[model samples]
Target chain A: MSLLTVGSVAFDALETPFGKTDKIIGGAATYITLSASYFTKENNLVAVVGDDFPQSMIDDLNQHGVNTEGLEVRVGGKTFFWSGKYHNDMNSRDTVEVQLNVMENFDPIIPESYQDCQYLMLGNTAPSIQQMVIERLGKRPKLIVLDTMNLWIEIANPDLMSLLKLVDVLVVNDEEARQLTHEYSLVKAAAKIHTLGPKTVIIKKGEHGALLFKEDRIFFAPALPLEEVFDPTGAGDTFAGGFIGYLAKTDDISFDNMKRAIIYGSAMASFCVEKFGAERIMNLTQSEIQERVSEFVKLSAFGLA
Target chain B: MSLLTVGSVAFDALETPFGKTDKIIGGAATYITLSASYFTKENNLVAVVGDDFPQSMIDDLNQHGVNTEGLEVRVGGKTFFWSGKYHNDMNSRDTVEVQLNVMENFDPIIPESYQDCQYLMLGNTAPSIQQMVIERLGKRPKLIVLDTMNLWIEIANPDLMSLLKLVDVLVVNDEEARQLTHEYSLVKAAAKIHTLGPKTVIIKKGEHGALLFKEDRIFFAPALPLEEVFDPTGAGDTFAGGFIGYLAKTDDISFDNMKRAIIYGSAMASFCVEKFGAERIMNLTQSEIQERVSEFVKLSAFGLA
Candidate 1:
C-alpha cells in the first residue's frame, strides 16, 4: 500500500518560554511524510516549496524513505515562512507572521506513480487546494483523511463543507470542532459533522487527549503527561502521519484497527513535543518507538476481571 | 468493611443553559453518600444539617443503604445553602450566594460504630475541619481519601499541607492541582504533590476524563460523552465516593484495584451530570451500573497485537 500527503512544506520561526528558534524546517507535509516514513517505506509527498528551500532537508526526507518526486520547487520565489510565539501555556499561540509565497497558488500536481497510492492525507491547507488534489487523482484512494483549521472553517466554509463529503476522516482540534458546528458538546458536534460528511471524526484536545467517533462507537487516547513541552510545533501533523501511516502499513480501516492507530499516533506525538521542531522524531529508533508504545499501554492499561 | 463520609449536606440553587433549579438537595456528602450507597451497605455519613432540611431526603438516604445515624440536625439552625450560575460552557460557574448557616461551626463527631470504618472519605470542606475529623479517629482507617477545593488551597495553605500528609489518596481537579504546586504540567503537579504526602493522586478533568497516578504507574479513564450535561455540581464528590466505596466493598487497596475503581468512579460521575442535583443517581439499578461500566470498557479498550 502507498500513502500520499499534500500540504505545506516550509520554514518556521518559533518562540517559546524555553527559548526561541531560527528558521527551522517545519510544515504539515514535512511532519506528515517524515512521520509516516517510520511506519511505511512507500510514503510519498506532494507539496510545493520555493527554490530557497534547502536541498539537505529534501535529502533528509529521502533518507527517511519518503519519496519527494511530487514535491515541486518554484524558481526565484520565496519559500512559505511563518513565525509565531507560544504563550506561557503552550496550548495557545499567536501568529506574528505568515508569508504564503509558494503556497499562494499551490497546484498539487499529482505524479503518475502516485496514482497507486491507496491512502491519501490532505494536510492543513486551503479547502480549495485540498479539493483540487482530490480531483486530480486518477483514482480515489482507499482511505482519505483531511485535516483543517478554524481559518478554513470560517472563511472557506462552503469549500470546506463540499470537501468534507469527499473525505473519509476529518481531523480537527477541540476548538475547531466547536467553531465549525456551533455545538459545545463534542459528541453533538461530531453528530452534526456526520450529517454533512466524514463519518469518522478525530477531535484533538491538545494535552488532554484525542477522541475518535464513528457511528455509535467511540474511542479515546490519552496524551502522555510530559514534564515539559519544549515546542509543540507539529504534534497534530505528526499524529495524523502516524495514524494514516500505521493504517497504510497494516492495510486495515476497521474501527478496532483505528483504535490501535490512534495509540501509535499518540505515541509519535508525545515524542514530537519532547524537543524543538521535529528533532526528536527525526532520530527515533524502532525500539524507542516500541518502548514508547509500551509506555502508552502501561499508562492506560487496566484489568477488569 | 464500612465506609465513612464526612462533609456538608445542604441545599443548592443552580442556573444553567438547560434550565434552572430551586433549592434542591445538594452537598458533597449528599452526593458522596448517595453514590457510595449503591456500592456498600455499611456506608456511614457524619455531617450537620438544619431542621429546615427535609426529612424525606434523609429517608431517601436511608433507603439507599446509607447510614444516617451520624447525620445531626440542629433545631435552631438553617441548612448550608449554595447558589450558582453555570456559564454557557457548563465547565465553569459563578458562585452567586453562600449561606453557611449550620456549616459555620460544624463538628464531625465520630460514632462508636463508625470507628470500625475501614475506608474514610473527607469530601470537599475546610482543610482544618477535614484534619479535625482525622485526628478524632481512635484508630487510623485502612484507607483515607480526601477531596479539597481551590479555596482551601488559597486560604488554608498550612492546614492543607498537613492534611495532605495524613491521607492515603488525594483527589483534586486539574486547575487546583496546577494551583497547589504552581506547576502547569499535570505530571509535574502530581509529582510535586507526592512530596507533600499522599502516595496516590487523582486529577479530575471534568468532561475530559480522570487520571490516576500512583508510585511509578499511571492509569486513565475516559468520561462518557453525553449529549448534554444538565448539571455539573458535585460531580467530583460523586467520583470520590464511587472510588472509595468500591475499594471498601472489595477491600483491596492495590494499584491494579485502584485502576478498576477509577473506571467505576468515572462511570458514576457520568451519571451524576445527567440530571439536576442527585436525581439521576438516586434510583439507579444494579444492571444500569454494570451496563455503564461495560460501556466504559468499550470506550477505552483497544488491542495492540
Candidate 2:
C-alpha cells in the first residue's frame, strides 16, 4: 500500500528547556515522511520548499523511498522558516517567528503516481491547500487523515469544516479539539466533532498520550514515559506518520485497527521528542519502532483480577 | 480485607454547567468510602462532622457497610460547608465559600474496631492530619495510599514530604505532581517523587485519565468517555477509593496488580462524573461496576496486526 502526505518541507529553529537548535530539517511533511518511512517502503510526498532548502534533506527522503516528484522547489524564494520556544512544561510554546517563504504561494500538484496511493495524510497546513490536494486526487483514497491546529480553526473554520467532511479521521491536540468543539470534555468534543464529519478523531495530548475515538469506541495510547524530553517539535507530525503508516500497511479502518494505529503513532512520537526536530525519528529503524510498540503494549496491557 | 479511609465528611453546594445542587453529601471521605464500598463491604471511615450534619447522610454510609465509629461529631459545632462553581471545562472550579466548622479542630482517633484494618487511605487533608492518621494506626497496614492537593504543597512542603515517607503510594493531580517535584514532564516528576518515599505515584489528569508510575514500569488508564459531566467534585477521591479498595481486596502491590487497580479506579471515576458529586458512584452496584470494567476493556483493548 502507498501513503501520500501533503504539508510543508521547511526549516525550523526550536528552543526547548533542555537546549536549543539552529536551522534543522523540520516541517510537517518532513517529519511525517521520516516516521512513516520506517513502516512502509512507499511514501508519496507533496510539499513546497525553496532554493535555500538543503538538497541533503531531499536526498535523505529520496533514499528512504519517498517520492519527492510532487514536491515544488522554487528557484528564487526562500524556504518556509519557523522559530518557537517551548515553555518549561514543554506542552505550550511561543512562536517567535513565522517566515512564510515559498509556502506563501504553495500550490501542490499531486502527481499521477501519488494519485494511486491508498492512504492520504494532510499535515498541518492551510485549509485551502489541504482541500486542493483532496480535489486534485482523481479517486478518493481508502482513508484520509487530517492534522490541523487552532490557527486554522480561528481563521479558516468554514474552509476547514468543508475539508473535514472529506476526511475519514481528524488528528489534533487536546486543546485544539476543545477549541474546535467548544467542549471541555474531550469525549464530548470527539462526539461533537464526529457530527461535523470525520468518523474517527485522535486527540493527541503530547507527553501524556493520545486518544482514538470512533463512533462509540475509544482507545488510549500512552506516550512512552521518558526521563528527559529534549524537544517536542515534530512529535505531532511523527505521530500522524506512524498512525497513517500502520493503517496503510494493514489496510484496516476499523476501530480496533485504529486503536493499534494510535499506539504505533504514540510510540513514534515518544522517540520524536528524544531529540530536536526530526533528528531522532529520521534515524529510527524498524527494530526500534517494534521495540517501542512492545513497550507501549506493556505500558497499557494488564490482566484484571 | 478491611479498608480504612481518613478525610472530611461535609456538606457541599456545587454549581456546574450542567446544573446545581445544594447541600449534598460530599467531602473526600464520603466519596472515597462510597467508591471503595463497591469493592468490599468493610470500610472504616474516620472524619469529623458536627451537630448540624444530617443523619440521612450518615445513614447512607451505613447502608454501604461503612463503619463510622471513628467519626467525631462535635456537640456544639457546625458541619463543614463548602460551595464551589465549576467552569465550563469542569476541570477547574473556584471555591465561592468554605466554612470549616468542626473540621477546624478535627483530631482523628482510630477506633479499636478499625485499628486492625490492613489497608489505609489518607484522602486530601491537612498534612499534619494525614501524619496523625499514620501515627494512630497501631500496626503498619499492608499498603497505605495518600492523596493531597497543591495547597499543601505550597504551605506545608516540609510536612508533606515527611508524611510521604510513610506511605506506599502518593496520589496527586498532574499540576500538583509538577509543583511537588519541580519537574515539568510527568515522567520526570514521577521519578523524582519515587525517591521522596512512596514506592508508587499516580498522577490524576481528570477527564484526560491517570498514569501510574512504579519503579521503572508505567501504566496509563483512560477515563471513560462520557456524554456529560454533571460535577467533578469527588472524582479524585473516588479514584483513590477505587484504587486502594482494589488493592485491599487483592493484597498485592506488584506493578502488574497496580495497573489493574488504576483501571478500576478510572472506571469508578467515570461513574463519579455522570451525576452530581458522589451520587452516581454511591448507588452503583457490583454488576454495574463489572459492566463498566467490561466496557473499559473494550474501549482500550485492540489486537495488533
Candidate 3:
C-alpha cells in the first residue's frame, strides 16, 4: 500500500521557555512524510517549496524512501517560512510570523505514478488546495483523511465544509471541533461531524490524547506523559502521518484496527515533541516504536469479567 | 465487609449554564455514602450536620442502607453550605459563598459497629480532622483511601504531607497532583507522590478520567463520553466511594483488582454528572451500573497483536 501526503514544506524558527531555534526544516508535509515513512516505504509527498530550500533536505527525504517527485521547487521564490513561540504550558502556542512565499500560488501537481495511490492524507493547508488535489486525482483512494485548523473553519467556511463531505476521516483539535459544530461537548461535536461526512472524526487533544469516532463507536488514546516537551512544532502532523500510514500498511480500516492505529499515532507524536521540529521522528527504530506502543497498551489496558 | 465514610454532610446551591439549583442536600460524605451503598450493605457514615439539616435527609440516607449513627446534630447551628457558579466550559468554577457553620468545629465520631470496618474512605476535608478520625479508630482498616483538594495542599502542607504517609491510597485531580509534587507532568507527579508514603495514587481528571498508579504500574480509566454533564459536584467523592466499596466487597487488593475498581469508580462518576448533585447516583440499578461498566470495558479494550 502507498500513502500520498500533500501540504507545505517550509522553514521554521521556534522559541520555547526551555530553548530556542532558528530556521529548522519544518512544515506539515515534511513532518507527515517523515513520520509516515517509518511505517510505509512508498510515502509520496506533493507540495511546493522554493530554491531557497536545501537540496540536501530533498535528498534526506529520498534516503528515507519518501518519493518527492511531486514536490515543486520555485526557482526564484522563498520557501514558506514560519516563526512561533510556545507558552510555559507547552499546550498552546503563538505564531509570531508566517510568510506565504512559495505557498501563495501553490497548486499541487500529482505525478502520473501517484495516480494509483491507495491512501490520501491532506495535511493542514487551505481547504481549496486540499479539494483541488482530491479533484485532480484520477480515482478515489481507499481512504481520505483531511486535517484542518480553526482559522480555515472560520475564514473558509464554505470550502472547508464542502471538503468535509469528501473526506473519509476528518482530524481537528478540540477547539476546532467545538467551533465547527457550535457544540461544547465533544460527543455532540463528533455526532454533528458524522452527519456532515467523514465516517470517522478524530479530535486531537494534545497531551490529553486523541479521540476516534466512527459512527456510534469512540476510542480514546492517551499521549505518553513526557517529563518535558522540548517543542510541539510538528506533533499533530506527525500524528496524522503515523495514523494513516499504519492504516495503509495494515490495509484495514475497521474500528478495531483504527484503535491500534491511533495508539501508534500517539506514540509517534510523543516522539515528535521530544525535540524541535521533526528531529526525533526522523530516526525512530521499529523496536523503539514497538516498545512505545507497548507502553500505550500498558497505560490503557484493563479487563472486566 | 464494612466500609466507613467520613466527611462533611452539608447543603449546596449551584448555578450553571444549563440551569440553577436551590440549596440541595450535598456534601462529600453524603455522596460517598450514597454511592458506596450500592456496593456494600455495611456502609457506615460519620460526619456532622446541623439541626437545620432535615430529618428527611437522614431518612433518605437510611433508605439507601447508609448508617447515619455516627452523624452528629449541632442543634443550634446551621449545616455547612457552599455556593458556586460553573463557567460556560464547566471545567473550572467560581466559589460564591462558603458558610461552614456546623462544619467549623466538626469532629468525626466512629460508631462501635464501624470500628470493625475493613475499608475507610476519608472524603475531602481538613487534614487535621481526617487524622483525628484515623487516630480514634479502634483498629486500622485493611485499606484506607483519602481524598483531598488543592486547598489543603496550599494551606495545610505539613498536615497534608504527613497524612499522606498514613493512607493506603490518595486521590487528587491533575492540578492538585502537580501542585502537591511541583511537577507539571502527571507521570512525574505520580512518581514523586509515590515517595511520600501511599503505595497507590489515583489522579482524577474530572471528565477526562482517572489514572491509578501503584508502584511501577499505571492504569488509566476513561470517563464515559456523555451527551451532557448536568452537574459535577461530588464526582470525586463518589468515585472514591465506588472504588473502595468495590474493593471491600471483593476483599482483593491486587493491582489487577484495583484496575477493575477504577473502572467501576469511573462508571459511578460518569452517572454522577448526569443530574444535579447525587440524584443520578441514587437511582442507578445493578444492571444499569453493570451495563455502564461494560461500556467502559468496550471503550478501553484494544488488541496489541
Candidate 4:
C-alpha cells in the first residue's frame, strides 16, 4: 500500500523556551514524510513550493523514498514561510509571521502514478483543496485521514463538514474538537464529531496524549512523558504521518491495528518535540522508534486484578 | 487489613459550568471513605466536624461501614465550608471562599479501636496536621499514602517536605507536582519528587488520567472518557480512597499490586465526575464499578502488532 500526503511544504523560524532556530526545513508534509518514512518506502508527496525552497530538503525527502514527482515549484515565487515562538509550556505558541507567497494559489495536481496510492493524508489546509484531491482520485483510497485546525472550522465550517463526510478519520486537537462541537468534554465532543461524518475521531491533547473514538469503543494512547518539550511545531503532522504510514505498511484498518498506529504516531510525536523544528524526528532510527514505542507500552500497559 | 483515613469532613458549595449545588456533604475524608467503602468495610475515619455538620452524613458513612467513632464533633462551631466556581473549561476553578472553622483547630485523636489499622491515607490538609496524624499512629502502618496540594506546598514548604519524608507514597495533581519540584514536564517533576523521600508518586491529571511512577518504572492509567463532567470536586480524594482501599483489601504493595490499585482508583474517579458532587459515585454498585473497569480495560488495553 502506498501513502500519499498533501499539505504545506515550506520554511519555518521557531523560537522555543529552550532555544531558537532560523529558517529551517519545516512544514506539514516535511514532518509527515519523515515520520512515515520510518514505516514504509512506498510514499508519495504532493504540495506546492517555490524557488526559495531548498534543494537539499527536497533531496532529503527523495532519499527517504518519498516520490516528489507531484511537488509543484513556482520559479519566481517564495515558499510559504511561518515563524512562531513557543511559550514555556510548549503547548501554546504565538505566530510571529506567516508568508503564503506560493501557497496562496496552491492547486494540488495529482500525478498519474500517484493515482494508485491506497492511503491519503490531507494535512491542515483549505477544505476545498481537500475535496478537490478526493474528487481527482480515480478510486477511493483504502483510508483517507483528514487533519484540520480551528482556523478552517471558524472560516469554512460548512465546507469542512462536507469534506468530513468523505473521509474515514478526522484528527483535531482537544480544543478544536470542542469548538467544532460546542462541547467541552472530549467524550461528548467525540460523540458529536463522529456523527458529523467520519467513523473515527482522534482528539489530540498534546502532552496529555490522544484519544481515539469509534462507535462505542474508545482507545487512549499517551504521549511519552519527556524530560522537556523543546518544540511542538510539527508534532501533530508528524503524528499523522506515522499513523497513516503504519496503516499503509500493515494494510489493516482494524481498531486493534489503529491502536498500535496511534502509539507509533505518539512515539514519533514525542521525538518531534525534543528538538527545535522537527530536528530530533528527522534522525530517529528504527531501534529508537521501537524503544519509544516500548516506553509507551510500559507507560500505558498495566495488569488489572 | 483495616484502612485508616484522616482528613476533613465538611460541606462544599460548588458552581460549575453545568450547574450549581447547595451545601453538599464533602471533604477529603468524606470522599475517601465513600470511595474506599466500595472495596472494604474495614474503614476507620478520623476527622473534625462541627454541630452544623449533619448527623445524616454520619449515618451515611456508618451505612457504608465506615467507623465514625474517631469523628470529633465541635459543639457550637461551624463546619469547614468551601465555595468555588469552575471556569468555562472546567479544568480550573477559583476559590470564592474558604472558612476553615472547625478544621482550623483539628487535632485528630486516633481511636484505640483504629490503632490496629494497617493502611493509612492522609488526605490534603495543613502539613502540620497531616504529620500530627502520622505521629499519633501507635505503630507504623504497612503503607502510608499522603495527599497534598499547592496551598500546603506554598504556605508550608518545610513542613510538607518533612511530612513527605514519612510517607511511602505521595499523591498530587500535575500542577502541584510541578510547583513542588519547580519542574515543568511531569516526567521530570515525578523524577525530582521521587528523590524527596516517597518510594512512589502518583500524578493526577484529572480528566486526562493518572501516572504512577516508582523509580525508573512508570505506568499510565487513563480516566474513563465521560459524556459529561458535572462536578470534579473530590475526584482526586475519591481516587485516593479507591487506590488505598484496594491495597488494603489485597494487603500488597508490590509494583504489580500498585498498578491494579491505580486502575481501581481511576475507575472510581470516572464515576465520581459523572454527576454533581459525589452523587454519581455515592450509590455506585459493584456491578457498575465492574462495568466501568471493563470500559477502562478496553480503553487502555490493546495488542501490539
Candidate 5:
C-alpha cells in the first residue's frame, strides 16, 4: 500500500525563542511526505509549488523515497511563503506575513500512478481543495485521514462540514476541536464532532499529548517531555505523516493499530519540535524511532493485575 | 500496613457549573481518608474540627473503615470553612471566603494506635504543621508522601523545602512544580526538586494527566476524560490518598509498583470530580473501583509491537 499526501509544499520563515530560521522548506505536504517516507518507500505527494521553489529540496524528498511526480511546478510563479514569530512559550505564534502567490490559484492533478494509494492523507488545506482531490480520485482510498485548522472551520465551515462526511478520520488540535464543535469538554466535543462524520477524532494538545476517540473507545498518547522545544512549526504535519505512513506500511486500520499509529505520530512530532522546521525528523534513523517509541512505552506502561 | 493522613477536616460551600452545594463535608483529610479507606481498612485520620461539625460525618468515616479516634473535636470552636465558585471550565476557581476556624491553631496528635502506621500522607496544609507531624512521629514511616499547594510554596517555602528533604515523595500540581523549582519544563522541574530532597516527584496536571519522576524513570498516567466535571475540590488530595493507600496495601514502593499506584490514584481522582464534594467517591464499591481501573487500562492501553 502507498501513502498519498495533498497540501502545501512551500517556504516559511520562523522566529522562536531558540532563534530564527531563514526561508526554509516548510509546509504540510512537505512534512507529511517526508515523514511518511521514513516508514514507507512509496510516499506520493500531490502539491503545487512555484518555479521559485528550489529544485534541491525536491531532490532531498526524492532521496527519502517521496515521489513528486504529481507535484506541479508553476513556471514564473512565486512559491507560497509564510512568516511567523513565536512567543517565548513556543506554544503560540503570530503570522508576520503570508504570500500565497502559487496556492491562490492552485490545482492538484493526481498522477495516474498515485491512483493505487490506499492511505490518503489530506494535510491542512482548504476544504474545497481537499474535497477536490478526493473527488478526483478514480476510487476511494482504503482510509482517508484529514487534518484542518480553525481557519477553515470558521470561514469555510460549510465546506469543511460537508467534506467531513467523506473522511474516515479527522485530526485537529484541542483548541481547534473546541472551536469546531463549540464544546469545551473534549469528551463532549469529540462526540459532537462524530455527528459531523469522522468516525475517528484525534485532538492534538501540542505539548500535552494527543487523544484518539472513536465509537466508545478513547486512547491517549503523551508527547515526550523535552527540556526545550526549539520550534513547533511542523510538528503537527509530521505527526500526520507518521500516522498515515505507519498505517500504510502495516496496512492495519483496527482501533488497536490506530493507537500504535498515534504513538508513532507523537514520536515523530516529538522529534519535529527538537529542531526548527523538520531538521531533527528529516533524517531520523529507524533505531532512533524505535528508541523513542520505547521511551513512550516506559512512560505510559503500567499493570494493575 | 496502616495509612495515616493529617490535614483539614471541615465544611465547604461550593458552586460549580452544574449547580451549588450548601455547607457539606469537605476537606483534604476528609477526601483523603475516604478514598484511602476503599483500599485499606486501617486508614487513620488526625485532624481538628470544631464541635460545630456534625457527628454523622464522623459516623460516615467510621462506616467507611476510616478510624476517627484520632480526630479532635474542639468544643466551642468552629469548623474550617471554604467557599469557592468554579469557572465554566472547572479548571480554575475563585475562593470567595475562607474561615480557618479550628484549623487556625490546629494541632495534630498522633494517636498511640496511629504510631504503628507504616504509610503517612500529609495532605495540603501548612508545611510547618506537616513537618511537626513528621517530627512528633515515634518512628519514620516506611514511606512518607507530602502533598502541598501554591500557598505553601509562596509563603511557607522555607518550611516546605525543609520538609521536602524528609519526605520520600512530594506531590504537587504542574503550576506548583514550576513555582517551587523556578523551572517551566516538568522534566526539568522534577530534576531540580529531586535535588532539593524527595527522590520522587508527582506533577499533577488535573484533567490532562499526571507525571511521576523518580531516579531516571518517568511514568505518565492520563486522567479519564469525562463528559462533565461536577466539582474539582479535593481531587488532588484524593489522588494522593489513593496513591499512598495503594502503595501501603500492596506494601510495595518499587518504581514498577508505584506506576500501578499512580494509575489507581488517577482512577480515584477521576471519580472525585464526578459529583459534588466526595459524594461519588464515598459510596464507590470495590466492584466499581475495579471497573474504573479497567476503564483506565482501556483508555491508555495500546500495543506498539
Candidate 6:
C-alpha cells in the first residue's frame, strides 16, 4: 500500500518553556511523511521547499524510504520558514513569523510514480491548493483525509467547503470545529460537518484526546498524559501521518480499523511532544510504538462483570 | 456494604443558555444520594436542611432507598441557596449569589445505622466540616472518597491539607487539581497530590472526560458526547456518587474494578446534565443505566486487531 502526503516541507524556529530551537526541520509534509514512513515503506511526499533547504534532510527522507521525487526545490528562493513561541501552558502558541517564500504561488507536481498511491493526506495548506492537488490527481485515492486550520476556515471557507465535498475525512481542532459550524457542542458540530462534506470527522483536542465521528458511530482516543510537553510543534501533522499511514499499511478503511488507526496516531503524537520539533518521532523503535499503544490500551480498557 | 454520603442538601437557581431554573431541589447530597441509590440500596445520607426544604424531597430520598434519618431539619432556618449563570459555552459559569442558610453551621450527625457503613463519600463542602464527619465516625469505613471545590483549596488550605491525609481517594475537577497542586500538567498534578495524601486521584474534565490515577496505573473514561448539556450543576457529585456506590455494591477496590466504577460514574454524570438539577437523575431504570454504560464501552473500546 502506498500513501501520498502533500504539504509544506520547510524550516521552523520554536521557543518553548523547556528550551528554544534554531531553524529545525519541520512543516506538515515533513512530519506526515516521517511518521507514515514507519508504517508504510512506500510513503511519497509532494511538497515544495527552496534551495535554502538542506540536502541532508532530503537524504534523511530517502533513508526512511519516503519518495522525494515529488518534492520541488525552487532555484533561488528561501525555504518556507515559520517561527513560533509556545506559552507556559504549551497548549497554545503565537506565530511570530512566517515567510512562505517557496510556497507562494506554488504548483504541486505529482510524480508519475505517485499516481498509484492509494491513500492521500492533504496536510494543512490553503484549501484552494489542497483542492488543486486533488483535481490534478490521476484518480481519487481510496481514502482522502484533509487537514485545515482556522485561518483558512475564516478567509477561505467557501473554498474549504468545496474541498470538503471532495475529501472523505476532515481533521480540525476543537476551536475550529466550533468556529466552522457555530455550534458549541462538538457532537452537533460533527453532525453538521457530515452534511457539509466529509462523512468522517476528527476533532483533535490537544493533551485531552481526539474524537472520530462518522455517520452515527463515534470513537474517542486519549492523548498520553506526559509529565511535560517539550514542544507541541508538528504533533498534529505527525498524528495525521500515523493515522493515514496505519490505514495504508493495513489497507482497510472500516470503522473498526479507523479506531485502531486513531490509537496509533495518538501514540505517535505522544512521542512527537516529548522533544522539540519532531525530534522524538524521527527515531522511534517499533517496540516503543507497540508499548505506547499498549499503554493506550491500558489507559482506556475496562470490562464489566 | 453500606455507603454514607454527607454534603449540603439545599436550593439552587440556575440560568443557562438553554433556559433558566427556579429554586430547585439542588445540592451535592441530593444528587449524590439520588445517583448512588441506583447502585447501592444501603445508601445513607447525612446533612442539614431548613424546614423550608420540601418534605416531599425527603420522601423522594426515602423512595430511592436512601436513609435520611441523619438529615436535620431546623424549623426556623432556610435551606442553603445558590444561584449561578452558565455561560453560553456551558463549561464555565458565574456564581451570582450564595445564601448559606442552614449550611452556614451544618454539623453532620452520624447515625448509629450510618456508623456501620463500609463506604464514605464526603461530597463538596467545607474541608473542616468534612473532617469533623470523619472524626465523629465510630469506625473508619473500608474506603473514603473526598470531593472538594476550589473554594476550600483557596480559603481552608490547612484544613483541606489535613483532610487529604485521611482520605483514600481525592476527586477534583481539572482546574481545582491544577490549583491544588500548582502544576499545569494533570499527570504532574496528580503525582503531586499523591504525595499530599490520597493514593488515588480522579481529575474530572467535565465534558472532556475523567481520569483515574492510582499507584502507578492510570485509567481514562470519556464523558459521553451529548447534543446539549441542559444543566451541569451537581454533575461532579453525581459522578462521585455513582463511583462509590458501584464500589460499595461490588465491595471491590482493585484498580481494575475502579476502572469500571469510573465508567459507571461517568454514565451517571452523563444523565445528570441532560436536565436541570437532578431532574433526569431522579427516575432512571437499570436497563437505561446498563445501556449508557454500554455506550461508554463502545465509545472508548478498541482492539489492535
TM-scores vs. true structure, each candidate: 0.99, 0.96, 0.98, 0.98, 0.99, 0.99
Candidate 2: global Cα-lDDT?
0.89
The digit string of per-residue lDDT tens for model 6 on A1-305 reads 99999999989999999989999999999999999988999899999989988899999889889999999988898899999999999878899999989898779999999998899999999999999999988998999999999999999989998999999999999999999999989999999999998999999998889999999999999988888888999999999999999999999999999999999999999999999997898899999999999999999999998
What is residue A105's positional error in candidate 6, in angstroms? 1.3
True-contact fraction in model 5 equals 0.82
Model 3 - which docking category?
Answer: medium
**Per-candidate DockQ vs. reference:** 0.82, 0.65, 0.72, 0.84, 0.80, 0.90
* Full-model lDDT for every candidate: 0.93, 0.89, 0.91, 0.91, 0.92, 0.94
**Candidate 3 residue lDDT tens string, B1-305:** 89999999999999888898999999999988898888899999999999899999899999999998999998888999999999988898999999999888997888887888889999999999999999999899999999999999999999998899999999999999999999988888999998998889999988788888998888888888887988898888889889988898888899989999999888899999889888898888999999999998788888964
Candidate 6 docking DockQ: 0.90
* Residue-level lDDT tens digits of model 5 in A273-299: 888897887788999999999999989
Interface RMSD of 6: 0.6
True contacts kept of each: 0.82, 0.68, 0.70, 0.95, 0.82, 0.88
Clashing pairs in 4: none
Q: Tell me the spans in candidate 2 whose CA falls farther than 4 Å from its real position.
A: none
Top candidate (DockQ): 6
Docking class of 1: high
List residue ranges in candidate 6 displaced over 4 A.
none
Steric clash pairs (candidate 2): none
Candidate 1: residue pairs that collide: none
Question: How accurate is chain B of model 4, given as a TM-score from 0 to 1?
Answer: 0.98
Tens digits of per-residue lDDT, candidate 3, A1-305, equal 99999999999999998899989999999999898998998899999999999999899889989999999998999999999998988888899999999999998999999999999999999999999999999999999999999889989999998999999999999999999999999999999999998999999989888889999998888777777888999999999999999998899999999998999999999999988887898788999999999999888887764
Interface RMSD after interface superposition, each candidate: 1.0, 1.7, 1.4, 1.1, 1.0, 0.6
Per-residue CA lDDT of candidate 1, range B203-260, in tens?
9999989989997778888899888999998888899888998899899999999999
